[model samples]
Target chain A: MSTADNPIAVLVELRDGAVARPTLEALTLARSLGTPVAVWLGTEPDADAVAQLGEFGAAEVRVAAIGAEARYPAKAGAAIAAATEDASLLLVVSTFLNKEIVTRLAVTTGAGVVVDAAGVEFVDGEVEAFQTVFAATWNVRTRIAGKAIVGVRPNTTTASAAEAPGAASIVPISVQLPATRETVTAVEPVAQIEGVPLAEAPVVVSGGRGTGGDYALVTELAELLGGAVGASRDATDEGWISHEHMVGQTGTTVTPALYVACGISGAVHHRGGMQASGTIVAINMDPDAPIFEICDFGVVGSLFDVLPQAIEAVKAHRGA
Target chain B: MRILVTVKFTPDLQSQRSFTDGTVTRTADDGSMNELDENAVEAALQLVEAAGEGEVYALTVGGADAVAAVRKALQLGANHAIHVNDDAVAGSDVFGTAAVLAAAIRKVHDENPLDLVITGMAALDGLTSMLPTALAAELDWSQLTLASSLEVGDGNATIVRHLPDAHETVTAPLPAVVSVTDELNKPRYPNFKLIMAARKAEVMQWSLADLGVDAASVGAGASRTTVVDASPRPPRAHQQIVTDTGNGGNALAAFLIEKGLA
Candidate 1:
């Protein structure tokens, strides 16, 4: 197939059997590149998901029926490769699992892969991806020569419905998965956070050493803003919060629309993970906290004092 | 049991990092064994210590400065150290680097079978987190990545992988590749005796030809991507700071309200 006609495959991730917010954003991104072909890795998606994908400009929904084994990267990567044989580029939500799958896919297909991309575009008929590196201090533009797999971070692209939406045709695919030694013995699903997933949350409120092991105010503010609660390495290391909620270079990297750092020192490691946030707001007792340098708005005060008043003001605003 | 742990030398995270000619500028003065690799070395040492009769080989593929990675692993109590340094290996992407690592691993495996290969979750400089998966693909081995906790016995390795959504327990047979997260274990500081011994240890060095990998197929020429442009991101503009007497929360809320971020 010619490059012009080659489809842009968007790997659709599902949460609760529905299209994930990041996948929708990816579909929206794929539509601009070419014909958006939604690639579903597991069992067939219900009609609602198909319709949702279609609304997001997926011209076709290709379901790779790989069953339970699809959770494995080798199996899932093979299925995706089989499904996107004619695709010029593949776009995925840049989670750790998806990065592995795409990396394996790139190895198998000899395609270039770039993950944690802030944006990707076609320049001079070649794919160029924009990403932040070195603790989000540098912006690099990478050009992929041929077939490419770009893992885009959550909240990077706006999820929008197509202007001219239509019914998407579903194409079922069967893949012959290769033999691998890895086996998933068991999966324990963690209890879901009350609101959005941390990575995909539009608003994130993170606490650090100043929380004093008390996440009560942090959780309250996060709930009030419909955001996700996050912790610094200090808090996680102190066993104040689970490691999954830790945001840093070694932990989860979040790109939310609004990132609120409370009493966090904003070490470079922490900054590397969250510096790309759209608008940063920091509340800390220390005026010299590094977070204030990057934050669009900063409040120098104890979070204990600031958060409660902020919470009440937010409530009042919502009520008004 | 035998294990091979891959380590990398990377620029210190605190250093002023920048890219030159589309690649990260490297210097021996500012580079050290990647911070995360300490966890990999620790995991390997613990696994071997538990096995009671096993060896751990620390391997690194890079330029001259990269040998420091394996040396650090040796200081951490690795029984053996191997450094693959070749000019052609410079500027290699993850795929190219994986090819070299896998070839070196195969050479070691041929000498004596390896039970597992362990690596850090990701390199701090690149932070791609793709090398372990790429190495597994290149070696045609099972890949168990992002392990927060791990256990090995009965010819199989089981790992507890903590993800944002779920906690998954994955198992893979021996001869697999596993990448561990920092949550796995606290790395032990090198004792004075081991540190002194590591300083005098002879590191086995090899070239691409020695590993039987063609230099042509694993360098910038073979790379599928090129960095067209790079620059330091300009700082955030119009920053505002407020000292909260009592209305700090009101100001915070008002700021969010004005920005439509609330």
Candidate 2:
């Protein structure tokens, strides 16, 4: 039985052996709900990572030393379940892998789970999650009946340090991992695109069929803005860009501070993925492109003509 | 090889979706098979076809209108269709739904051992992507999800999962549960003969009692989450459209600078 004062466990994801940015954001969100306890899944974190967690208001760090087996989602989930015995709610960064882990944890603990949540709040001692559904057309609020596990989307909350640093005492816990039938035979790394990840990028510049199988200009503009380069399904289908860079209902859904659609006629499918962006700008040759309907700024012109000029103007402004 | 593929009836992606009484309002006219499940159906068909001596069963759990989902699978060359429909099954969350699915799967497995159970990576409507893992846990079966490519040979199933971080090749023994992504293969359209036959095909219907699923354990009352409120997001405000005349790029840059987003 969890009271209002019970600790909330925030699953800490480590990238390159450091706490990931999204986990920091999750920790920040957890602070308002309850005492934030950072739960690290793998081996012991270094001093810097622990300090970082402490800086974000995690009063204590529960380390589940699952080690190499953490690659298996079930094993990691079990570790979390064991480590978070005193927690009222579990917060995680919503990735596909994390979703699976939290699902297993929810089942094992009989907890209610809501993933891809944009925000969460406590209402009358119950957890309520807010999310956009059906491609950002509707906003839905879900209330968990019992113990809650929320998989929050990346970039939904800003990561801020606490006014006073937390204790950040380290606690190591042991878990009994279940045997699984599935075996990972091999793992091959894929070269990641440069700049920020598409889902977490503050600015996203996407190209479409109008790019004519060329992403040079799109890449250039995105680089100038310190953003990620994205592509429409048509552009990816035409083999102009890899599938990871595709943004649509079937691909990555990004909620960036600024979204620039160049040479793209926004279909409802595409709009569903990015309509929630803070600011939208479109440059299309077609005067009546649907992208213009939702964009805060629309330019009816050739992206080839507009992008280069925009690039130069940005450069001139920065230099000035 | 005997395989079972799970399908879902969902509102068309282009339809106007709404929630009534804290649940998605499903009408017969506005719903069909989930688009992503086509890839699962296609994978099942390909696996059975390659084996040259196996049966493919398409199973769906929903209201009466959900029969459309299995019928769509039948048109795609599935040998059998199963529709598990009961009023008590309404408003079930992913966990409750998984329990119902596992019970139905057990009933089918008892009659004839199933070599594999397959599903889509995620249902387009819910987009939770959690059912496959939940169902696998309920059944205590090996779960191989998000497979971009799958193969079955020598009593084992292998898949290559293309995740954001890495591409992993995983292998599991038979009697596993697999969920495939759209990148696996292009789903084939229904042929004329199969389409005609599927229209008149008899679908096996089962109630909660038939599958021995307790009504109290698998409906709105059993769900752990409840929808508190739902509404359409307001449209964007402050519209600005400009026809670029050489100075368009400068205007875009100026706007970005003003917003402090440059």
Predictions in order: lDDT? 0.91, 0.90
Model 2: which residue pairs collide? none
Regions of model 2 farther than 4 Å from truth: A1-5
Off by over 4 Å in 1: A1-4, A317-320
lDDT of 2 at A273: 76
Expressed as tens digits, the lDDT of each residue in B1-262 for candidate 2 is: 8999999999987788999988988888988999899999999888888888899999999999999999999999999999999999999999999999999899989999999999998987888899999999999998899998888888899999987778999899989999998888999999999999999999999999999888999899999999999998887888888898888988999999998988
Worst 10 residues of 2 chain A by lDDT: A1-10
What TM-score against the true fold does each predicted structure earn?
Answer: 0.97, 0.97
Question: Which DockQ values do the candidates obtain, in the order shown?
Answer: 0.77, 0.79
Docking class of 2: medium
